[model samples]
Structure formats: structure tokens, C-alpha cells
Target: MKTTIAVLGAGSWGSVLASVLVQNGHQVRLWTRHPQQAAELNNQHTNQHYMGDYQYPPQLQTLTNLAAVLKNAEVVLFTVPTPAIRSVAEQVVPILHAQKACPLIVHASKGLEQQTHLRISEILTATIPAPYRQEIVALSGPSHAEEVARKDITLITAASTSLAAAQQVQRLFMNNYFRVYTNTDLIGVELGAAFKNVIALGAGALHGLGYGDDAKAALMTRGLAEISRLGVALGAQPLTFIGLSGVGDLIVTCTSIHSRNWRAGNQLGQGKKLTAVIKDMGMVIEGIKTCQSAYELARAQNIDMPITEAIYHVLYEQADIKQEITALMQREGKSESY
Candidate 1:
């Protein structure tokens, strides 16, 4: 059966997922804020800004008109950056009418807003009416867009307040190369998905400094500890961090050369300025911005997250990277188990 999916963002990840849906024999309409980009995709069957090399189906509708694309969508996949989620949600709320049966709303974005400090799901629930609240779900995991777009084997998870909603997404999306799992721990999934990018920056920096695998491994281990600690403090299950969204995502983002966050951190570790690093990477590095938000959340929650704190200083305070490394090394030792 073919389902109609409206993908609300035509970035690399969005385009990749749209193409995946097309592969699954679904009708996919990819929406972009840039009219020119939408025109190109609609006419050329290719997204030059994001997935330039990959060819999409001619049937895939690329539209700048949000209302038309979303009118009767069976599933609405929001793939914009975290910063843009609130405004987009607000804009779409009025268009959500009662006459038509509502669709499942899924968020593929990772990161909390720095100013509002609200997670993506929270933003959706606050913006959408109560009737549509239960339909929201977050789909995330270790799967990278670059790899997944290439039709490589990738595994991801769909989390929702209702297990039935999660299972619906899992059934709708699972494929031979693309595996989807269902989990009810939305907090753990969202937090782990968002925070791992911050740690990936540190991981990339370690590699840039000519650090050995042992050093990178230690940083990743400690980073997960801090992430798990904070996650549990904020109502997430402690063991959720060990699952696909936690350790799975952390390892992939930290080690992959394709990861924008890791690439940005590499430049930073090599002594490039923050502005210069982002300018060179040429894409959204969620981890850099996420570090700031995570730092703020840690402070607000009174949770100790030394790794996130150190990265925040490096990003915003102009702290010397070498000194930051030394500071982490000099911290008092504690029991290995947290």
C-alpha cells in the first residue's frame, strides 16, 4: 500500500528520507523553504543543495507550498533543524483542520533550542492542538544520512508516548537495508540523539590532535557516562543510553568522516577559529550548537556534565583547546563505574 508522506525540509537528511520513501513505493512530497530549490527538484528530479548526486523519482513532488503538500498527508515528517522547528510548527497549526483525519507527525531533528531550551517533541505538543498531540513521534538513531542515502544497511529507532504509534512507524519504514525499531522512551531517545553530537565534536578534536585510539576511546566512554548521568537525572531511563540511540549514535557520529560535527571539531582542534570551522564545513553542525544548549540545560537542571561544559567553553568562551584537554585530564579521579 502506498502512503502519502510530506517531508518538511529538503536538506540532506530530508532528501535522503524522501528518496527512501519513494523506494518503499510511497508518494513523497518534499517541501523546501527555498522556492528555487523546490523548482530544481520538481523539474530536475535532483536536489543540488543536498543530495546532488542521487537521483529521485520523477513522481516525487517538490513543492514550496506547505499547505498543498500537507493537505492529505498520511504521515508528516519534519526534518528541519531544531532552531526552526517552533516557528514551522506554529505556522502549520492553523492549517491542521478537523474535517480531515489527522496524520502522524514525526520529527527527525536532533537538538534542543538554546533560547527556549525545549526539545523537538515538546515544541510540537505545545504548538499543535491536543487532538494531534498523541500522533507526534521522534525518529532517530545512529543512521547517517550520507550512508542511508546510499542504500547502505542502517538501523534506527522510532520513539513515541504510545507504543502503538512507535510500532506504526516501525512497520511503515522498516526495509531490508533500513531497519526500524520501536521504543517508548522518548526522553532517552531524544536526549541521547541530541547530546551525542556534542560528544562527537570532542571525539573529532581528539583525532585532529593526533591522539591515539586509546585516547579517543576514553573520551567516548567518559562522554557516554556524562550523557547517561544527565539523561537519567532528567527522567530518562539510565540504560537507554546503552541502546541504539545512545552508544550507537555516539560511535557513528564521532568516528565518521562524513559527520559535519566531527569534521567541524577536527578543524577546531587543528587551531582554526569557530567561525572559520563552520564556514569551511559548509553544513549545519548540530553538535556545536547543541553543546551550548546542553551546557545551559545542565546548569538549569543542576546536573554535572564536564565534557559538555568543556566543549561549551571551547565553542563560546574562546578557551584554548590544549588547556581544555589538560583541564579534563587533571580532574580528580573517581570510581570507573557511574
Candidate 2:
């Protein structure tokens, strides 16, 4: 069945998703804050700045007016960064309130709000009213926008408290090259999606510092342990960590050159300042902010996350990365299955 979809944001992921939805035979209106971006995407059918020469489907519409984009939309998919989700949701609230029927709300963003530490769905629920906020779903997994743009064989999980809602998203996004699975563990999916970015940052740092595969393998293995611990503490299912959003996302984000988070960490590992790295990347490295939120959450919950703690210090406290690694290595060892 065809759907009228409103895709928020014009970043690489957002643009690629809009293109995919167009390919899926949906009426996709991609909303961007900048008029120039909208005009370029609409007229040129390409987003060269972010997507790097990939041609978007000409059917994909780009718009600056939020109200216009939301008009008669059946699904509102937010592809904005975590920090911008609330602001965008606040804008969508009044428009949605005027509508007769509520659209299915879905988000591809993966990060916790800095202060509240809320997931994207929680932020949507808090900002959007009950009528418009029904059946919120999170679309996540080891998906890189560049690869997905090339029609790579990508598998992801669409998670929601409502199984039907998850299935709906699964149907909307699933294709021959892109597959979607439904998972009921919303908390686990969101946590796995967010926490893995932090781990990917660490993995990139390891690479930038010239650490071999053994070091990265150790970091990834133990990083999954840390993610699973905090995730379970926050009420996520244990098995979800090993699923697509958890281990799968972690591996791709940490290893792939397409990952902004991993690239940011690599720059940081090479002794560049965080500000410089972020500025140079020209994209949102979610792990930078997520590392802070996760660090605070872990500390408050009394969760033992040495890798997170180490990354947090390196990013925020101006601590020497080498020294932090030394401290981590010097800590008393314990059984792998604690």
C-alpha cells in the first residue's frame, strides 16, 4: 500500500531515507530548515554536500515549510540529530493537533537527550500529544546512509511497544536490498542504538592510535559487555544487545569509514581537539554527546563502565588518552563473566 510520508531533516541519512521511500512508491516530502538545501534537493535532485554525488529520486520533494510537509502525511519520520528532535517535535505538535487522524511516528535518530537522558521515542512522547504520539517506533540497526544509498543488503530492526506498529514500519521500509525485523524491546533497541555509538568512538580511537585488530577486538567485546550491563540496568532485554541494534550496529559504526562517530574518534585519537574534530567532520558525531549522557547515566546508576568512563574523560575532562588507557589496563582484572 502507498503511504504519504513526511521525513524530517536533510542530512545524509534523512535524504537517503527520503529517496528510499520515494523508491518504495511513497509520497515523501523531505523537510529541511534551510531554504537553499530545500531548493537544491528539489531542483537538482541531489544533495552533493552530504550525499556525495548520489542522485536522489526526482519524485522526492523537498520543502522548508513544516506545515506544508506535515499536511496529509500518514507517517512522520524524524531523521534529525538527537539534540534537534525535541525542537522539531515541538514544532510538529501544533500542526498535528489540527489534523483529524494521527500519523505513525517513527525516528531513525539514535542518542539520548543530554540532560533528561531520554530516548528519541520518549522525547517524542513528551513533546507530542497523546493523539499524535500513538505507537512510536524506532528504526535502527547497522545501516550506513552511504551504503543504503547504493542499495546495499542492509538489515535493521523496527522496535516499538506495539508489535503492529513495528510491523507497519517493517512493511514500509523492507525491500529486496533493505530488510526490517520487528522487535518489541523498545528500550533495548534505543539503548543499543545509542550506546553503540560511544563504543564506536572508542574503537576509532584505538585505530587512530595504531592499535591492532586484537586491541579493537578486545574493545568491541568488552564494549558490548558494558553496553549490555547499562542497557539491562535500564530495563533492556539481555538478548537485544546481541541483535542488530546492538552488536551489529556497533561493528559497522566502529569499523566503517562512513561512520561520522568513528571518524571523529579517530581524529581525537590522533591528538586533535574535540572542537577541531567536530568542525572538520562537518557532521554530527552522536557519540560525542552520547558519551557524556551515558557517562552520567552510568555513574548515577552505579554501573561499572570503565571504557565509557575512559572515553568520557578523554572527551570532556582533557585527560590524556594514553594515561586513561594505562589506568584502564592497570585496574584489577576479573573474570570475563562477572
Candidate 3:
């Protein structure tokens, strides 16, 4: 079953995903907003700015016209940033309507809409036409673009309310090196992906402050607890936190140097301002935005998420990171409860 897939976004994750699809014998056409990037990928088989020396599959193609690629694509994968999801979905609506085709919608983004606090799947459901809305699956895990590009063994979750939708994604990408697991817990998978980034920020900040290894471990552990609490409060399964999209993701994003969010937090811990860190990263550090949205969501739902609140204050309110840490430590202790 060779599928024609249209991958939206040419960032690190997007390009790598396109390459993997090409390797699986799918006709992959990457949609990039920048003409130069598309031209480079087509001509040199390398996206130096995003992928860095990783050779794209020779069969992969790049296109700037979204409608052209949507022409025959059986699957539309979104690897864009949270802020861009809405606009991109809006752009795809008429194209799908015009084509009279319904493709399996898969979103790999790991952030919520800042204003609406909606997950990527929810955003797409609201933005795209009803005809194209069957089951939007979320593909997420600890798998980073760099490691996946290197053909490292990676595991991820494909979650959707529709089991068929999830299995469709699993068969589309799973291989010897990449394993995909299907779960019907859409809320859990989506929240796990988004909230883990918030926790990863705190983890990176601790590392930047030269905290002890035990402190980092405690943060990661407690961070998982906080993520679980908030996620369950928001209608997600608690056990999902222990899965690849949850604990698995938190471990990699918090400790790996390849994580832009962790690197951004490291800069903040090293006494750099938020604006300066964002400017220097040259990439969208999703944790910063997810911190804001998740903080607001917790408050709105009366959910207790101390770590999320702490990172939000540090990133947006200019609160002293150490003071936030001290406050977190000084809070009334609870009996190791989630």
C-alpha cells in the first residue's frame, strides 16, 4: 500500500519524518513556505539549516504549493509549530474541499494553542471542514528528530479516539528501527506530549543552575507527577503518563542537548533573558509557549500544577528562577501523591 503523503512544515521534525516516509516507499512531497528551503531540499538533498548534513531520501520531493501536494495525498502530516497550526489548517480546508478527498490527518506538534488552550488535533477539527474530519491522530513520543534521523531505535504513540485512525498511522510509519504503538486515549497522548515540554523547561533550568544530579532526577520525577495530575484533571488517563508520549518524552526532552526547549531553559538558567534565549535558538522552543497555555489551562480548570506555574512565571513574568525553585521546595509537603 504505497500512499502519497503530504508533509507540512520543513523544520527538523518535519524533514526527518518526510525522509522516513520516503524510506518506507511512500511518495512524499514536503510543503515548505520558503522557496529557498524547498529548492535546497530538491537540489542538494539536504536541509542544512534544519537537518544538518542528514541526507534526505533521494526519492523525496519538495513543493511550495500546498494545493499541488494535497492533490493526491492520502495522508496529511502536520509538523508545524503550535502557533502556525490554525493558519495552516485554514489554508488546507479549501484545498481538501476542492480536491474532494479525505486524508488521514496526523499531527506531530507538541503544543497547545496559546489563546484557546486547544490541542493540535482539536484545533484541526475546529479549523478544517467537517468532511475531512474523521479521526485526527497524534503521533508523539520521546523520539527527537536528530536521533530518528540517525536511524536510532525509537518508539512512539499514535493516539486517536478512532482505533482505525491510530492503526492507520502505525502501519504508515512503523519499521525495524521505528516502532509505533496505538492508543485510544487521545486526550492523554496529546496532553502528555504538550505538558512534557513544560516540565522539560524546569528540568533544563535546574541543569543550567548547576543543580545536583539528584535534584534533576527529583524534578523529572515530580514533573511527571504534576503532568499526570493536570492531565487526569483534564479528562486524560493517568496511565498514559507512563507511556512513550509521557515519561518517555519527558526523559529525552529534559536531558537531551538536542532539545531546543531544554537549551532555551539552560540559557535562562545561565542568566540570559527570555527574549535573548528565544532569539539565539533560531528555532521555535515550544516549551515556552506551552508553559503559558498550560498554566492558564490549569488555572482555568482549578488544577494544581505547581511546576507549570513556576515555569510560566519565570518565562513570562520575569520571576527569579531560583526564587521559584525555593518556593517550589518550600510548599506544604504532601504524601507522595499524584
Please report the candidate that would top lDDT against the real structure.
2
Estimate every model's Cα lDDT from 0 to 1.
Answer: 0.87, 0.93, 0.91
| Candidate number achieving the greatest TM-score relative to the actual structure | 2
Per residue, candidate 3 scores C-alpha lDDT tens digits across 1-338 of 89999999999999999999999989999999999998999999999998889999879989999999788889999999999999999999988988888988999999999888999988999898769756799999998999999999999999999999999999999999999999999999999999888888888888899997899899899889888888998899989999999999999999999998888888889999998888899999898888888888888888888888889889888999999999999999788974
For each candidate, give its TM-score against the true structure: 0.96, 0.99, 0.98
Which has the higher TM-score value, candidate number 2 or candidate number 3?
A: 2
RMSD versus native structure for model 2: 0.8
Candidate 2 whole-model C-alpha lDDT, 0 to 1: 0.93
Error of 2 at 110 (Å): 0.6
After best superposition, candidate 2 residue 191: deviation in angstroms? 0.4
Q: Report lDDT (Cα) of residue 284, candidate 3.
A: 93
Candidate 3 local distance difference test against the native: 0.91
> Per-residue lDDT of 1-338 in model 1, one digit per residue for the tens?
88888899999899888888888889989888898888888788787767666777778898888888787788899999898898888877767664354788999999988778777899888888776544789999998788887889999999998999999888778889999998899999999999999999998898888898998899899999989988898889987899999999999999999888888888888889999988877778898888988898889888888888999999999998889999989989878886
lDDT of 2 by residue, 1-338 (tens): 99999999999999998898899989999999999999889888889889978989889999999999999999999999999999999999988887765999999999999899999999999898887766899999999999999999999999999999999999998899999999999999999999999999998998899999999999999999999999999999999999999999999999999999899888888999988998999888899999999999999999999999999999999999889999999999799985
